[model samples]
Structure formats: C-alpha cells, structure tokens
Target: MDLSNIPKPIWYALTAFLLLTIGYGAANHVPGLNSSDKESAENKASTVPNSSSVKVSVFDEATQAPVVGAKVIVESQGGSDTDTTDNLGAFRVQIPTTDYVKVRISKNYCEPYNQDLNLKSNPDRPKPIFLKCSVPQKKYMPSS
Candidate 1:
C-alpha cells in the first residue's frame, strides 16, 4: 500500500486507534492496570461451584465474648472468598468447590487464626472455628 496518498487526518486517526489497541492489551495483562470490576467478575465466574457454606465464629479467649467485625477468608487451590463477622461474631461464607481449604480469621486487638479444613467428609455441618486474642503487655517505665 502507498502511504504518501493517505490524508493527514486519516493517518492521525489510524495512529490513535493503533495506540489505543496496544494500550488496552497492555492494561489487561499488566498487574494493577486492569479495572477491578472486570477482574472480580472473572474470578467469580471461574470460582463458581455447586455451592457449600462454612460458618466461622470469633471470640475473645479470656472474656469468652464474641468478637464482632472480624474478617474471615477461605482459600483453596481453585479460589478464595472473604466475609466479615456479624454482631454475633459469626460469618458464613460460600465455598466454591468441595475441596480442602485454608480458613483464616483476623480482627483488631485479637490474634489471627488459620486452619486447613477438609470439606469432602462434612459438607453440610462444619464445626465452628474459634479464635483467641492475646492480651496486650503493659509497658514498664523507669521512675523519674
């Protein structure tokens, strides 16, 4: 094709289109460049399963009181899901598939908890997972 005959506007438009195509391709492949909404949608689609639920509860070890607003995460070879504890300190999350997964729970002013669970045997009823918080140590100051 002869490029000398092409108009300036047409060349500019073609250049802009080519640049846009390249940018879009790079954004999709580069980490953190792609929009989160699209990434989350893909993750959800790939991790979908027949559906199973797991309940987790967070509590203070010394006071034996429920810990509210705790974050819970369930991860497996396939994918992972996250949830937060309610006022009752309980969080229920849906599992993508019936497989072994690692459950992690964390809350402010409390110790984090992690455990590997096997969902193959008990799919319906899973034992409640508990987390213990460590007492903050008091700092001693020298007498002035």
Candidate 2:
C-alpha cells in the first residue's frame, strides 16, 4: 500500500528488508565484489611458477658465517643441472613448482657437506635461504 497509509514501524521494516535484498543481489553478481572472484583469486595465489629461480645461500656450520668461494651444486629430482653458486656461496637456481633439490657445499677448510632442499612451495623472488656446511678449523702445531 501507500506509505502514508501503512503503519510507521511496518514501513521502516519493509524499507530495511528491501535495502538488504538489493545489497545481497549486487554483491552476488558483481565481479570484483563477488565471493566467487575472491575464491578464484585465492586459488591463483596458491599457484607457483615451476620455472622460477630462487636464490639460496650457504653458511659455515660452526660460525654461521657466509662462506665465500664455497662450491655449491644444485641438482633437481630429474637429475638435471639447475644452476651453480657464486663466489659468495650463493646460487641462483631455476627449480620446479615441486622438486627435491640437492645442495652440496664444500670448501678447502671444511669437510664435504651435502644437503637436501625440498622446494615444494614456490618461494617469492629474491628470498635468501641459509644452508649449513661442515666447517673445520686448521690445526696449528707449535714450531717443533
């Protein structure tokens, strides 16, 4: 009926109900505002680039210091060479979205080191990952 003929409380309730219904319809149909879009965005965000390269660093096991010139080899699960480490004991290696990576760090002063890096989740770019190595100190014999 007409607003002037309806009771005031009923009029307010009807108005509130209509406003809520419009909002619900718009929220369901709008692309950027719909729940489906939010769900899709979350799914996309979970996806990782398999071909991306991640940077990892090697440090001395004893002192936790960066071991420059340390030899590091990165091999994938498929027995393919990804990349090699730099002089700073850092390596930029291209890995898969999910991979079993092998990291070998060695230096003249340290014992042979081997590590297995499981890269199932694609870590964001330029992330620094620290690895452990077997570092040995040189023995000093007094001038005998």
Candidate 3:
C-alpha cells in the first residue's frame, strides 16, 4: 500500500469515485427513495394516452367497508404504475389506453386481489374492487 508516488489528480479522482459510490449506495437504501424514483422514471418514459385513467377502490369483503392505504399496481404492455389508496380506499392511476391491463390490489391482513381487466370494454370510470381478509384457520386437535 505504498502511495507516496501517486499523483494528486489520480488521488482526487479516486476520492471522487469513492464518494459517488457511497452516495449512490446510501440513496438506494433510503426508504421510499428508490421506488419513487423508479415510478417517476416509468411515468416519464410512458408514451400512453394521458386521458385514460383507472380508478381502483379496495373494500373489505366481510364488512363491505372501505380499506384504506391499500397498495394498487396496474401493469400493461407499456409499463407499470403504483399507487396507494386514499382515505376513501380509492386510487386513481393514469394508465395507457390499452386493450388489457393487469390490476393487483393488496393490503396488510387482507388477501391480495388480482384481475386482468379489459379496459376497452370497461367504462371510463373508477371500478370498485373487494378484498377478503386472509384469516388463518386453526387446526383441530384430536383428544388424546
């Protein structure tokens, strides 16, 4: 590790590279930073019609109550979009006007709901989707 003869410019370049590497690694690990960046990039890269929108609402199957803070993902041939439901348990995501798109809705303690929708046939309005709670059943023990 004899660096006494190393040039100042080379040392500076190496230091800069190391700093950049550390900064990038730190940024990637920050909560919500990576996903937000990717989502923004995907949105900018999308070439779909801006007029088309998909409205997804999550509801509890048993109680028929709105499930807030649900994660909604819509995927099409163009790209994928992610959103979270509001207090009304609704997420309106702008999507490309395509023939078909896959929609997935998930929430903690609830079973994920997935469906392939025909956007062309469906009306240009928000659709309500229901999700059932995934309550684990207990096993019955036999008497000894």
Candidate number of the best lDDT: 3
Instruction: Residues 71-100, candidate 2: write the lDDT tens digits.
Output: 666666533333345666675655444456
lDDT of 3 at 52: 71
Worst 10 residues of 1 by lDDT: 38-47
Model 3 Cα lDDT, one tens digit per residue, 57-121: 78888888889898889988877788789898887766666778899988888988889977775
Off by over 4 Å in 3: 1-39, 42-47, 134-144
Q: Kindly give the stretch of ten consecutive residues in candidate 2 with the minimal lDDT sum.
A: 39-48
| Cα TM-score per model | 0.55, 0.45, 0.58
Which whole-number lDDT from 0 to 100 does residue 111 have in model 2? 70
Where in model 1 is the C-alpha error above 4 Å? 1-47, 134-144
Task: Please identify which of the two predictions, 1 or 3, would achieve the higher TM-score against the true structure.
Answer: 3
RMSD of each: 14.7, 20.7, 12.1
* Global lDDT scores for all candidate models: 0.73, 0.59, 0.77
lDDT of 1 by residue, 1-144 (tens): 789899999999999999999999888745467765554542352436665666666677777787788888888776677867879888666656667889888887677888898777766664566677776788999899
Superposed Cα deviation of residue 138, candidate 3 (Å): 15
